[model samples]
Target chain A: MTVTLIGGEMLHWSDRPATPALPPVGEITGRTLVAGPHPHDLIASLPAERTTVLLRGLPDAEAVAGLGVTVWAGSLDKVAATPAFDTIVALDGLDRLCSAEAETLDGWDERLAHLLTLLRPGGRLLLRVENLFGVHRLIALPEALGDSEWLVADDRDPHRPAGLAALRERLAVVREYAAYGDALLSREVLADAELSGFVSATIAGALATTGEVLADPAALATRALRHGLALELAPAWVVVTGGAADTPDAVVGAKAVAAADPPRGRTLEDELIAAAQRRDLPAMRALLTAWQKSPAAGVPAAQVIAGSASPAASDLTPLAPAGDPLVALSHFAAAAIRGDIAHLWPAPADEAELTALIAGMTGREVEPADVPPLPSRPAPGAVRELTAERDRLARELAEARAKHEFYEQQIRGRDAELKRVRQINAVLSATAPGKAVLGGLKAGRRAVRAVVKRGRA
Target chain B: MECGVHHANHYYGHSAVLARYCGLDDEAPRIQGYLQHGWNIGDGLAPDHEFVPGVPKFLWSERVRRRAWSLGRRDVYVVGAPWAYLLALEPAAPAEREGTIWYPFHGWEGQHVLGSHDNLIAEIKATEPGPVTVCLYWQEYRDKAVRATYEKAGFRVICHGYRGGWWKDLDPGFLYRQLAELRRHSRVASNRLCSAVFYGTLAGCAPAVYGDPMQLENEKSAFGGQARILREWSDMIGAEVDLETARRVAVAELGADRLLPPAELRRLFGWPAPRSTAAIELTGVLTS
Candidate 1:
C-alpha cells in the first residue's frame, strides 16, 4: 500500500487517494519462480506467462494451478536448475530451507547464500517474513496465540522472524521497509484508504477491523521519507537485496541500509552525501571528481572536497596503488584525523590539492592546523631483538605442551587397555572353560613332578 | 520460515482441519509471537521455536500446559487444541462407519516410532482385528513396503497418492473426500498420532492408546512423546477416546470461551494475503 499525504502534518485519509504505491508482484516478464505456498500475494502479483510456482504441499496446488500459472508440485531443489531465475520471491514459507529443516538457526545465512547462487547475475531476491512483534500481538486473543511454549516463553528466534536484523545482515539488504505502518496508530496504508469508518470496514479488507483507526500525524511517513523507516514497528519487513558483487555500486555493504528513495531529481551534492553515509567510495569519488570540475564545487567547495575526495580509510584496492592520488588522499585523511598531515600529497608541495581533498572527505572547511605534522617514532633495534627471543621461547613451550598432550593421551589409552585386560581375566576365571583350563594345567604340573620322581628312583 | 512442523505427514492436514472446524481460513492461523508447533518437542523445536522469535504459549491439554510452565513460561493456558474443536461438531451415525482402521506409526523413515515398523505390522497381522483399513503417511506412501507390509498381512489399505506431503493442493472438495474416507472407520489405532485418529474419532470412532515409544526412548531417538504436548497426543493413539467428552471438556474445561474471533485473529496474525503493493514496482503487473 502506498500513501502520500498532502502538504500537512496530518493525513486526512483522503490526502493522496490513489492506490497505494506498493511493489506489484508477478509483474516481471522474465522466467521467475515463487517457491513455496500461495495466496502468497506475491505470486498473483506476478505475470503468469513468465512465472512458475513451486509449491511445497499439495493443499494449495489446485488453486495455484487454476490461476493458469505453470505449477510444479515438488521442491525447487528437486526440480529447478541453478542460476535459473531473474528474480526469486521467497515470501511466505522459509522453514523449507535446509537450515529450518535441520533446526539449525545458525545456518540461516548460509541457506540464503545458497539461494543467491540460484539467481542470474544481478538477480533480485526479495525476502518477506512476518515480524514477531507485529501490532496484532497486543490485540490478539489468547486462543489465537496458541497456548504453547512460544506464547509464554522466550520469543526471539531467528527462524520465526521476530525481526529482520539477521536477515538484513545476511542479504546485505539494499532496502528494508515494513509494509504496515505505525502499529500503535494504524493510519492509511495508501493514499486511497479512507480512515473514516476504516476500522468498521478494514485496512486491507482481510485483517479484522480494529474499529479504532489511530492517527499518528505523519510521524512514520516522515521517517520513511528520510530513509530511516522503522522496520521494528511495521507489521512485516520486505527486503530488496542484490547478491554480493565486487563493484562498489553493486555491493551492499554489511551495514548498508536502503534509505527511502528520495525524489528522482537529486542534486549531485545530495547524492554525494548519501554515498558518504553508505560508504560507497566509488560513488563518492565519482561525485567528488565531478563536483571538483563543476561551478557548485566552489560554493561550499571546501565541504564537498572534505566529504568525498580525501582518503578516509585504507580499504581501497587494485585501482589505487601506494602513491596514487586517491590512495595518497585517503592516507592523508587518516593522518589528518590523527592531527598529522605530512605527505598528504607527494613531497607535501600540493597544499591546495591537499586542502581540497580534506574538504571533500570530511565535508568540513580546511584549516592550517588541520594539517598537523607527523608524530615522531622511536628506535626499534633493541626492542625488536628482545621481542624475537621472547617469540622463540613461547613457540618452544607451545610445541612442548603439544608433545606432552600427545604422550598423555597415549598413556591414558594404555591404562584403559590394562584395566580392560584385568577385567577380562577376572571374567575368565568365573567361567567353566577358564576353570577347566586352570585345573588341567595344575594336574599336568603334578603329573610331571611324579614322573620326574619316578625317573630319579 | 519452514513452519517447523514435521512434514509429508498428517501435519499438513492440521491447519486444514483447524480451519475446517474453527471457521478459519484454510491457511494455518497466523498467530502472533512464535509458534512452537507443539511445545517441548524442543529438540527440533527449540532453545526456542526455531523459525520465530515468539514466546511459547499452549492451548492444549493440562499435561502440555504443565510442561510449558515447568519450562519457566507463565503464559500457559489450557485452552485446548484449536483443531480438537472438530470433535465438537456432530459426526455421522455408526451405520456410516465400517469396521476398525489401523494407522501405523511413522517416523522420518519409520525410524523412531519404533525400532522397526515391521514389528508392529507383524504383531497386528497376528491379532484379533486382522482385516483393518490402513491409513498411510505420505512418506510411507513412497515406501512400497509400508503399503506392502500391511497388504501382506491381509488388510485393506488406502494411502495418500500425492507427491507433495499432506497439505498442498488441498481444496474443499478434496477435504470433503478425505474426511468421508476417514469417517468410514468406527475404530482407529496407531503407535503415533496420525490425522486419521484425530478426524476419525471426531467422526465417531473409538481411539485407543497402547505403548508410547517417545516415552520409552531417549529425546534423540524420538519426537513422538518427547514434548509434553506430543506425549499427550501420542498417548491418545490407543486410549479410550471420549471424542464427545473431550470436545465438551475442551470447550468448558480448557477455557474455549477465550477463543479469539476472526477479527481479533486477523489483527494478531500474519496477513490473510500479502498486502504490499511494493512488489508491483519491483517487477511486473498481473492482469487478474
Candidate 2:
C-alpha cells in the first residue's frame, strides 16, 4: 500500500531524531512518492525501501545520504505523478498553496483536481485547510477602550481563506466528506493585556487563535454564516478526508443532533455582566443555573457586572425554583437552619407538607431565606469599574511599595557608607601624618584660588 | 490513549482523561491517535517490555494497524480516542446537574490553554450559589507562577495539590486522578481540548473550550490518519466546540450504534476473550 504525504514542510520544524510522536514515514513499503516537508520523518520511517519525497527547494546532499528514500527536488505544485497510491495524506498542502498564491481561490481548484488525478479510484485524500471564520476572528480583534475590552462583535479584518463554501462547491464531485480542524483551545484575554491579533506574528497577546483554540471553528461559523450572520470565524487549518469513488456514509460522531439546549449560563464574564445590567431575567437565570456550583462564583460576577434593572430582578422570580418541591423543602430547611421561620416559601403553603419535604430533603429536617436577597444594583458604573480601578491601583501601589522598599534599602546603605567614609576621613585627619597631608592640600587649594584671583585682577 | 505534542504526554493524559467521566483503566486498550505520528511506528523501533503482548490490541487508526502489521504484529484494533468513546458511554445530563468547575489548561511556562485572564476563584466565589474548583495540569499543580497568574487576575487561588506543603507527593492514583476531582463540577471551560474538554463534556458538565493553546498542529494526528477513522472529532474544536456541537453530535450519534456497532467492536476488540491474570492486569476488561 502506498501512502503519499502532501504538504509544505511536514518536517520543517520536526525534531532531527524525531520524537516517537512523529513516527517514521518508512511504513509505506511499496513504491512511494512524498511531497513537501516530511523528508526527515519519511527517512526515519523507511527501511531500505523504494520511497521518494519531492522537494520544492534545493536538496542538502549531506542530509540525503544512502538512507533508502530518494529526495527529488521537484515541485509537487501540479501533483503530476501517476495514479497508483491507495492513501494520499495532503496535510494542509492546499492551505499552504493558497497562502503562497496569496489567498486567491484561483488555481486552487486545479491544484485540487491534480491531487484527485493522482489518487486511485478508491483512495482517500486526507486534506487539511484552515477555517475562514473562527472565534478568534471574534475575540482576537484589537481591543477598544484603552485596549481593555474584547471587540467581540466588531471585527473588520479581511480574512482570505479559500473558504469552505467554495471548497464544498468544488468537493461536491468527490466522494466521502469528513471535516474537522485543530483549534480546540479557547482564548480569553488576560484582564490586563489585549490579545495579539489572530494569525499575526507577535506572540505576546494573551489569547491567540493558533496558540489557544486548537479545534477548527469553521463548522460552527458556517452555521452562522449560512444564517447570514457576518463575523463567522474559522480555524487555522481544517483537515478533511474525501474518497474518490465510494459514497460517504455517516462516520461515528458525524451525525448532528437537535439544537443544543440553551447554555445553562453565560460563561463569558463580560456577557454575564451585560445581562445583569439589563436585568434580563432569562439570561440571568440561565447564567445562575450554570453558576450554581459556587455560591462565591455568582456574587463576584454580579458585583463586577452592573446595569439599571430594566425589568428588575423581582420580575424574574417566576423562573426561579419557587414551585420546586425540593426548592421549597430546601428553603424551609434553610430557614429552620437559620432559625428564621417568620418568612417561609414566599406565600402560604401547607405547613405539614413543608415539614415533610424538608425532612425528606435533609434526611432529618431542613435550609435559606424564602427569597434570595436581590444584589444591590450598583449605581450605573459603580461596583465593577470601581473594583477594577481599585485592583489596578492596588497592584500599582504594591509595585510602588516594593520599589519604595528597594530604594529605602539603597538609601540606608548609602547613608551608612557615607558615615563610614566620614569616620575614616576623620580618623585619617586625627593622625599627625594625615593631618599634615590634609593641611598641605588645603593650603595648596587656597594658594591656587589666591593665584587665580590675582591673575583675574 | 491519546498522544501529541500538546503537553508532556498528551496521549497519555487524554486517554487517561476518560477516567474523568467513566471509571476506566489506563491499559483499557486505546489507540493514541492523538499523537502526531500516530500511524507510523517503525519496524525497527524498540518493542516495549513493560507492555504485555495483547489479547485485545488497542490502536488509533487503520494506518497504525497496517504499520503494526508491517512490523509483524497483528492483534490490532482500530478505536479512536477517548472522547469519541463518549458517544458509546452512558449519557451525562448537565442540565440536571448543579455547580460549575473551571479547568485552566496549564502549559510549560505558566501558560493556560484558554488564555484565561479572569480571576476564576473570585468569579466562582462571587456566585453566591455557585462554587468553583480549579483544575490544573499535573505539573502546574506545583508551579506557583501559573497558579499565581490566575491569582493575579482576581482569584484567591488554590492548586489541586494539598492544602499546604503537606500533600505535595501524596496521591493514591496520581497518574490518572483528575477525573475523580473533575466529577464534582457540573460545568467546565478550559483553553485546550485536553483532559478537561474530553472528561468535562462526557461527565455531563457544560463545557467551554476557550484560550490560547500551544503546539496544536502537532497534535492533529490525534484526529486519526484515515478518512472517517474518528467521528465528530471535527465537531469538538473551535467555535463549534464552544457551541457544544460536539455534544449535540455525540447525543445524536449515541443510538446504540453512534460509534462503530457492538458487533464491530466485538469483532475488532474481542474484549471479552479469556485471558491469563497477568494479561488481564496489563490490559483492562471492557465492560458491557
Candidate 3:
C-alpha cells in the first residue's frame, strides 16, 4: 500500500479549471491514502481499497498504518517522524524548502552529507530544487511581487493612496521591464531599511505572502509536511521523495496532485506581511515603525496591542517603572474629581481648625526670601569664558585617555617582542663555537709560558 | 584584453596557442614542456625525472645546461616543471646564473600550479638573480606557491597568468579520427575501457597530445572505465616514448573545437563570444 501526502485547500481542488484527469485506481493497485486538511470528494473516486486519510493540525500516526511505504508530501522535514518506508515520493520538496527561506537554513551541508543515511543503500533520494544559479529566481521575482502586493492591498488597507501608487509602480516596472528591474526595488528597499535601523521592513514583503499563501488549507498542509520532511521550518511547497529502490512507478500517479499550477505571483506587501507573521519580532517591529513613518501611516495601536497580547511579544516589551509615580498621581486626581475624596483622604472634618491654619499662614505674612541666587543674568562675555573653560577641560581629558591607551599598547607589544628576541639570543649564545676555540688558545699559551719558566730555572 | 581563452584547462588545447603567441615554434630550442607531480615528505625530494630509472641525471641536466652554455650562454633555461628542485641542486654554475628556474608556486592540483607553503616560496626566492612570477589562475584554485614563499623570504614577487586568449584553434577531424582509432585499437585488443590505456595508445600512435594527467582521469572516468586507469596510463606513457609526442597527441584529442563545436562549446563554457568563424576556419582548412 502507498501513502500520498497532499497539501493545501481541497476546495480549490474541485474549483480549479485546469485540474488534470485522475488516473483510475486500477493503475494504482496499492492501498493509497491521501492525507491533508481539505481532502475533497474529488479524489474519492479512487477504489475503496485505497484509503484516504484527511488530517488537520498535527498528523495522525495511525494513518500511516497498513502502508508498505510512507511518502512525504513535501520536504524531508514534513513527514511526521516515522520508520523508513519501502518507497517515498517527493515531487518537488527540496526546491520549495530552499526557496521558502533563502535565509535561516544552516547545516544544509551536513544534511546533504547525511542524505544517503536516511535511505537504504539502494534506495534513491530524489530532489528537485529551483537552481539558485538558474534564471527561474530572476523571472519569478516579478510574479511573486505582483501576487503578494494584490493580497496585501486587498486584506490590509484599501485607503492608502501612496501604497496603491507604489504598488502600481512596482507592477508596471515588473510587467514592462525585465525581472532584474523588479528585483532592484526589493534590494533598494531592503538596503534603505537596513540603513535606517529597520531591517524587518525588508522581510515584511516576503512574510505577507507567506501568510496569505499558507491561509490556503492545501498549501499549508503541503508546506507543513514538506518542511517536516526536510527538518526545516515550513516554507512554500516543493516536492521531496526518498526510500524508493530506484524511481518508483507509484510516484508517477502521485506527481499529478503534487504538480499543481505554480503560485500566481504574490506582491511585495504580501511577502512583508508573511515575513512579519513568521515570528521575527525585531524585523516586524522595525517594519511597523517604518510603515508608521511612511506617508500612508496609521496609528497601528491595534497592532501594538495584538503584538503585546502574545506571550513572546510581551517578553519583548520594556519594563515598567517600579510603583509608577505618574500612575499613582493620575489615580489620586481622578478620585478627587469624582467627589470620592473620602476614599483617598477624609474631608476636612473640622472647618474651624482649617480656618485657624489658614489664619496662622496669613499672620506670618508670606514674603519672598532675599536669596542672592539669580545674579541678574550673566553677561555674554562671562558666559563665553565659562564655555571655553568647559571645552578646554573636555579636550584635555580626551587627549590624556587616548595617549594613555596608546602608550599601554606600545609597551605591551615591545614586551612581547623583547621576550622573543631574548629567547632567540640565548639559543644563539649556547650554540656559538667561539668559546671553545678561545679556551683552547688560552691553554696553549699557558703551556708555552710553563716551558719557558722551566728553561730559565 | 581578451582573457576568455585562458580560463580553459590546458588539456583543452590552450598551450599550443600560448606557444604560438609566445613565438616558441621553430625557434631556439624551447623548454621541451612542463610536467608536474606531487609527493609527500616520505617520497624522496628529487625522485627520478627520467622514465628509465638508471639514466644519468647529467643526461637530462645536459639538455638544459648545453642550451644555456650556447650563444655566449646568455639565454635562460626557464624551468617550470616539477623537477626544477633537482635542477637547482646541479653543479653547473653557468646554468644556475642564467637558468631562471620557475617552480609553479601553486599545488599541482586544480587550476593554480603554485603552492601556498611559505617555506617553499622562500626557498625559491632565496635563489638570487631569479625572478619569481606568481602564476594566479583566475576562476581556478588559489595559487600560493611562489608569492607565499618569496614574501616570507623578504623577496618581492610579480603576478602573472591573467591576460587570457591562450587557447588555440584545433581541428575536429583530427580529434574524431584519433578517438576512432583509440576505440578501434582498444576493441581489437579487448582492453578495459580506461582513458589511460586509450591515452597511452594515442601518445604512441596519434599526431599530438596535450593536457595533464587529471584531464586523462576526467575523460576516462566520465566515459566509463576502470578507476585505476590514471596510474596505469602515467606509467605506460612515461615509458618508451618522449614527452613531445605525448603532448601532441593530447592536443589533437582534447582541443576545444575538436571536442565541441564553437557555438556549443561557447554556450557550455560560458564564453563571452562565439568563435563561429574561427572554428569553421580551423575545421574547413586546417584538417583538410
Highest-TM-score candidate: 1
TM-score of each: 0.30, 0.25, 0.17
B1-288 in candidate 2: lDDT tens per residue?
111111111333433333332333432333221222122223211233122222224443444445656767533433444444433343333434455556664543333444334544444444424555565655665767777776554443444442111112333233234444455566666544544465556555666544444332333342242223223355555422444565553332221112332222322321222222222111111222
Interface RMSD for all numbered candidates:
26.4, 27.1, 47.2
For candidate 2, state the interface root-mean-square deviation in angstroms to 1 decimal: 27.1
Cα lDDT tens digits for candidate 2, A291-350: 322222223231112212322222111112223333433333232322223122111112
RMSD of 3: 35.8
Q: Report per-candidate DockQ.
A: 0.00, 0.01, 0.00
lDDT of 1 by residue, B1-288 (tens): 112232222333444444443344455443433322332332222342322112224344444444555655543333334433333332444556666677665544334433555676665555535247777766776678667877877778776443233244543333444556667766777665544455455455676544333222333534333344445543353345566654443233222333332222222222232233222111000111
Ranking under TM-score, best-scoring first? 1, 2, 3
What are the per-residue Cα lDDT tens digits for candidate 3 across B156-268?
33332332222223321222233333332211111122222233233233211112222222232321233443343343232134455444433332221122122222222
Off by over 4 Å in 3: A1-457, B1-200, B203-261, B264-288
Report the candidate with higher lDDT, 2 versus 3.
2
- Taken over the whole model, the C-alpha lDDT of each candidate is 0.42, 0.37, 0.27
